[model samples]
Target: MKILIAEDDLASRKYLDKILSQYGECDLTVNGMEAVEAFLMAWDVGDPYDLICLDIMMPKVDGMRALQAIRDLEKQKGVAEADQTKIIMITALHDTEYVRNSFQKGCEAYAAKPVNTEKLIEVMRQLGLQV
Candidate 1:
């Protein structure tokens, strides 16, 4: 499974990459703009990501906007809603608003900061990803 990990924090990103790499190829992005660009580029090249781990408070664009953009892009490409790439919102904030907005924007899951490897894997499995 191809995956994208978008986070501004170096350590968190690396930790996620290290653990998730066991599953498949992974791409890293520092901020939301890069995240969206990477996602679009992959789609354009017919190599769309299977999963996206997006951070909420990134530079340039925020995760909520990024999620909306990705969903919109999928729709523009005639990709069905059910077939859109899976997204997991990863952030430090536990605010109900963020969670609600993320789900409203089409994220498949949400992971709070200091992410748990075991729980993340469980969520991945629940999403039908062979992790």
Candidate 2:
């Protein structure tokens, strides 16, 4: 399971990397633009990520837009819905609007800041990832 973690905060980024590395190889990005670039590069090289943990707010591009771009790219590349990478939107926000928008943008799961390892793992299992 190759995972991409897109987070702007240094501590959050390191925390996620530490937690998620147990499951698979993790590629980290500091912002949404880098995340999208990494995603596209991986796809081009035939090494697409299995999961993407995207932060809602980041520099350059926001997570919502990034998610849309990623989904659109998958569609344009003819990748079926079932084959598309699993995405989990991670944010510090407690706003319901953000949650609603995340689902509407195709995220499989949503994790709040100060993520719980157990719940995250459970969510991964629910997504069919052998974590």
Residue-level lDDT tens digits of model 1 in 1-131: 99999999999999999999999999999988999999999998999999999999998998888899999888899998778898999999979999998999999999998999999999999998987
Q: Estimate the overall C-alpha local distance difference test score of candidate 2.
A: 0.96
Candidate 1 residue spans exceeding 4 A from truth: none
TM values, all candidates: 0.98, 0.98
Instruction: Write one digit per residue (lDDT tens) for candidate 2, span 12-130.
Output: 99999999999999999988899999999999999999999999999999999999999999999999999999999999999999999999989999999999999999999999997
Q: Which pairs of residues collide in candidate 1?
A: none
Candidate 1, residue 124: lDDT: 98
Q: Report the error of model 1 at residue 124, Å.
A: 0.4
lDDT of 2 at 73: 94
Candidate lDDT values, in order? 0.94, 0.96
Best by TM-score: 2
